[model samples]
Target chain A: MAKISVYRFLSAGCNGCDVEILECLVPRYKLADLGIEVVERPEEANVLILTGGVNVKGKEELLKTYETINPPKIVIAVGNCALTKEIFDKGYPMVGPPDQIIPVNYYVPGCPPRPQAIVKAVADILGVKIEEKEDYWLAPEGFRGKHEFDREKCMGCGTCAQVCTADAIDVIDGPDKRIVRVNYGHCSFCAVCQDECPTQAIRLTREYHLVTNNRQTTMVSNEVDLLSCSVCGGTFIPEKQIDWALKRITTEKVPAYSEFSNEILSAMKICMVCRRSIKNIREAKRLLTRLSEKVRGF
Target chain B: MPETVYIGPYRPQLVEPERFELLVEGNIIIDARLELGYMHRGIEKLFTTRTYAQNIALAERICGICSGIHTLCYAQTVERLMGIDVPERAKYLRCIYMELERLHSHYLWFGILAHSLHEHEAFLKIMGERERVQDLLEYLTGNRMNYLINTIGGVRRDITPEKAEKIRRTLKELKPLSDYIMSLLDDNGAFTKKTKGVGVLPRERALDVGAVGPTLRGSGIASDIRKEDPYAAYDKLDFQVIVERDGDVRAKALVRARETYESMKIIEQALDNLPPGDIVAKPGEPKVGEEVGRTEAPRGELVYYIRSNGTNIPERVKVRTPSYANNFAILEMLKGERLENARAVIESIDPCFACTDRVTIVDAKTGRRRIIALR
Candidate 1:
């Protein structure tokens, strides 16, 4: 059996992760029972456990420590910091994401991963396959993928942008050509944007699948426009929704409302006939009811 | 001869000049000199750039254990600056969260202190019971650590009657457990031996150094931010601030243990007298002005000074964390104590390294300056 040693490195990071790591070492989830030993020196350890992201001054020391450790050493980037650089990434002089600095063998993702997950990751890395059921309590709520906007449904209302605490949503194209753009990196999937959208245009898709070689592009979602009403010529419907239905049909690109001349506007559009018909039908129904009551009284 | 000692969260902690040259012929620490800053994150500098609303979130992230306290202070300071009134119900709800934070934080510190002192069984017992408070926090606020309930004017969530009932029942169940733990403090001779005479910070010295929370209360000073400043609905609720005259490790422990009981009682009272109304009031951004906000965190008084220049972003924000003040007394407490007792002496103050590491260190011998490291 190969001797495995783990050296946990934490620099200017929250102590909660370190405390939980200590708890894992205790009698309850004893890692020693599984041939894992925590060592004081990184050079002697077979596995390096990277905890906190590297802050300004700690960056050099972290790299130096990684260099001193022998080759064929497996690095396990633990927590959100080591994997994606959650909060600390925004801080000045940040040197986070172990993969950016060094090659990582495996990654355990979480604000602070549970002890069980850490244990499982370690077991899997050591060439042992262990199947475990997902814990629903640990799963994140709301959308984990890119944001989608239904353009046709959007009333050019900036409610989504206003309600977004993260400021990820932006109304880029002006009031006339209103287009909502979302920076997926800043979006926390809080669904505040979706809830605040007046027209029910913005929504979180159920797709959680994300993968990328570039960190910048990996987390962001691509934007798709909704389809508009052909008669009124309003791009109020999401482009995807219309495309899904009218993919087989031939449709010509209609001119924008501003582009239509007075002659073309009057000839091309039929204004509110359905709305007027509904109102007249309701009025006629009321008259007939009143007439029936008068005859009965006579 | 000046030896180097490493501090801060880094592995093989950064080595700093140690001016303390102890000539311990027997079992006494003859001399000690204070060394400062390896953990400074420039939080004050960073705050200058953040907006008033964004600053609230940033302030809360200062310390995970006392995140709620920081947010409360920040929100209050902004409200004061804007001259806006927080809803009556909001104040009561804030107090509930604040007290719950105190219960969990003190329990966490107790467990850590016990663990440092090598009382493994006691540490586990304390932490096991502490989870109930965390459970309450998770139930009340969505998250266990970062409870993002605070907004610019008031809180975001309201405590419904059904939720209040659940909180009351949990508090009732935990009351007996806290009492059982407190009983152990009286009979355990080992606990007394390790803490009673250790880390003695005299009342005058504590006051002179501007110690707050249990650190100050342990020194026989009846000073508490909740009592003195009376932010939120703390004034409405009837509760006594626990104090002890010993000014030692044991005194601090006793103050914390007693405060836990007082907190539970306050929670029970607040639950019964909870008012029915809106949890939050809509308010605009704060105009240009500076306002100081203070709140009693689990450790001590947390003060935030916010300055707005009539812009979306704040001109400057200065945070005086309780740990920053309480940590200054460490030099006085560690005097004439053994090296092994250093951890206990430090933990007794409930020093928040994240909060305290802001101070810059200047070398006495060379006048060279550097940040103090905290490990």
Candidate 2:
């Protein structure tokens, strides 16, 4: 009677976190021995477990549920959606982060954190002994590694960043250089970068030891010097990228490519915008010549 | 005269956000009106901004329960468009994960079904078995939920001989538990009393309203994408397309329970006949074209339509999820049933709203300006 109770709500989420949360209550895990119970009624719950990000509609409902729960309540935000609001972040449905609606006291982050993470969260909130799962039973061994960077080989074309679906790879523009930063924390270890890397520069070595909280500490970055456009003198692609492209294009010989002059080679060094502008000017000149020919006929 | 009861977009017992206004006379529901768009995340619109590889992660997030199949369908669709052939070994790897995912998902649904019926012991037992499945999956693929296994060309991870042996051992351990669970479902008079003849959607109505996966299979329709289209080395595996005659909650339960056994068998076959070769075939940049990918999700048949326009990013990505078809069929199943049966009927179809509602009818504003997944 009058024990600690939990009321779990999913704002607008994928069922992953919610299912994992449900997994903790299984007979194997048995969260009830800790004197915490998942109550159906919000009024009875002291721990409100939010499994999703708060959207516009969820903001109102979350607040309503938050208010209904009694005082001295602990709001534990489970999953990345609740902590970071990444599910529909900046989408039309999202109003703000979970903290904006109701203050979150604790956070358990993952696409969906393992069930132990959730149990630990519940226990931590309840002030109980947090039992961590044995590493062998939980995290699998084999082929688990963080992304590695080869500074000499990276052309800084941002292909890794572009190909990254996890949004782990970031192409940071510096005043003098371009940086390809790979965040190990967010990396899905899908190896798409290795597959998509044009230069075979970024690779995955079997090393899973580095785990850190600081974003900088976990970041594996490579920087390259920027190249100025031949036409506009604007900061174009990286110098390494230009060199790499030149080599790749030249090596894959087209019979017509053997006739390249210095002027043509220099024209190839123009930035994409300048290249487009040059093509437009050539079109305009042809149009003017066609008009003059019409005038001559007249 | 029928009275009206607006069930929820908000309620204590409800799992997801869905508003159902029911017209009931003496707790017997006559008609139902569904109100959607609580949080349509606009995932399809976001797809155009990301590269092919990036969308795999995005697709996995579509729904937690069947996240594997989303990647499977989307990858297959893009692969189809690009004319890239998946290696035989990779196909087997893909099948292994898909089956494991199916087992995990069905276990999840079964536990929820038990909970909905207030069978707490049964729920706990089923969830325990589910945890073991999750552990095995985690062993095979690094993460538990979104394995991130499938790629546009082939799969990312390969199952080694040691891993295969462990998987076989796990399956052996799981079989008895599966048998025990099937017996419990078949024998439990209390659960049967509540579920029998409850929320019956006949064969005609199931097909008429476009029910797919286990919901259709529960109604004795043996329509499975794995057998029909045979994606991901499923053609090599010999397993029955589990179907039940009754179109009620019990039939749905039987279909899912038996389907779990079939999944375990497929995994067994896949692991035994595990091939050797490259997991992925690297293809050139996708040309301008459109293609469709269909696969059987834990709930039903999932379809992904992808269009490319010569660039790395897709031109348009439309996901027609199994839940999209199965969710609508619930409306047909809900009519003239008691108010209490709504939860059972809805859960029977396993409504994956995140996958279902991809259309954004309008737009609004968020207070934050920072983009989430954009790099």
Candidate 3:
């Protein structure tokens, strides 16, 4: 293999991704052993490794650097910021994911991709084998990587979306179904979603190799059925959430709550607005009677 | 004729994007002016839009190398605003992580210095040691750079007994390597010759320029936030504040290198006296008020001023990173030095342009700004 020179451009986002790229040059990774050199100029380089997302000024600078590189050049966007702009996308000055401005050939995703992942990105593009130490940069036991969703365990309660550090999880409440989508591009791999999930429906699996050519395909989504209110006919809660709430009630030691479990389950079906509209005890009694009678038909 | 030389908006010497304009008469630099804000990402304005929990992640990204300290400072400030008392175990855990971060950061500085000095062998040795420190951090916190262990009321992670033991073993192994590196630095003629009398900042000028961290301490000032304010478990730990009187590039290097031992000692004490109990407190709702959280970051004093509006989100968050102060001192240090030593003096202060360049600077006389807004 000929000597491949790489020029790294540090853009506007945090410097975490650049630090990880430097890690590849350390003794363990031995980027020098692969006949790859980190050149000072883009003109001398065959590969351009860009870290961080570009801001307004950086976007202009990035384009100039891109034009300096010769043809037959490969551009690798490393880290979540470079791939999807991550948390900085909400900021005013940010104007990138790098691919929007220039044509990116490959994407290595992580808050900051591991050193081996970056080396793997370059090696994969050239179709070269990474010899020895197959488990060198393997994800550890508690490593936060790609988001994994369990459809059976999920109830679409949106707690993961609420606690997400990067606001990467989106809960779309449809008339019949609630769709919870986890966008890996915007994720920082903080695992706050997994920690706050009420049903343990989300997990950050130990699969850190998330590099891909397509940005749109880097998402995992789960859907659950939504139940409408009996009184107003408005979609309110997921059916699985109602079942989970009933299971919580049944596991309690109080016999009084369990004795009225049917009535409680029927009342849970009504949306808060309709239930609050009952002005008196007579109206509440009439609604409960009608709800119980309706519940029995099922 | 005095010529103007522009060093960068992009250069190999600087890690982040920053430019230096130098007025030089032949080989000597007469004056130096720094132009920054090229890497601004609007982090302070972004803080207002996110929830408190999300802000923790944002704070960590302010600077990647000293990430743990940023979160520690932010978390402590939020805790104060909410009037939450962190657990004893969490306090001690924070100290352990903070010192480990210092060791990692200082080693990284050494590696950069060595690389610029053309001591490739020393650079590799220091970076190898740094990698070990990062490996320990990764094993403990799951990430090498941005540990992400801090939360509003306490730490998100805990140090187990097995992990504590591993920390002790790693520090022990690192001691010999550090001593060998110190000897290499002391004996090498080329290393000492280039660094001995270069980039000299007198003690009075260092204080005048408002230098912080090792830059201030290297000039014989014993100012350290950990000693004066004592946030986290620093109050209970035993460690010395290393000081050097020379006020040169070598002085700052020596201060950082010697302080690594003090960091190791502090971590050992925190591990030995690790408290037993919960690692977190239930954070309460924010009461409307303003509070400041300050800590001794690896580079120097880091301050985060937070204003809460009786909600989950903060009304305002202002971060005063140590580099912001130390960067100004470079202008003073750069004066009257040879043009060749300019990069060394700048790197000596451990400038983090990403942390410093949060806003655009406009000259009062001309009323002009470098960055123009589009749309």
Best by DockQ: 3
Best by TM-score: 3
- At residue B114, give the lDDT of candidate 1: 72
- The model with the greater lDDT, 2 or 3, is 3
Please write out the lDDT profile of model 2 over residues B142-205, one tens digit for every residue: 6678778888888877777888888888888888767866776685655677788988989998
Q: Rank the candidates by TM-score, best first.
A: 3, 2, 1
TM-score (chain B) of candidate 3: 0.92
Off by over 4 Å in 3: A132-135, A231-234, A253-255, A272-298, B12-14, B187-190, B354-375
- DockQ for all candidate structures vs. native: 0.11, 0.30, 0.50
Off by over 4 Å in 2: A1-3, A122-128, A131-138, A142-159, A173-298, B12-15, B187-190, B353-375
- The superposed Cα distance between candidate 2 and the true structure at residue B278, in angstroms, equals 1.8
lDDT for B371 (candidate 3): 34
Global lDDT of model 2: 0.74
User: What interface RMSD does every candidate have?
Assistant: 6.0, 3.6, 2.7
- Please identify which of the two predictions, 1 or 3, would achieve the higher DockQ against the true structure: 3
Error of 1 at B138 (Å): 2.0
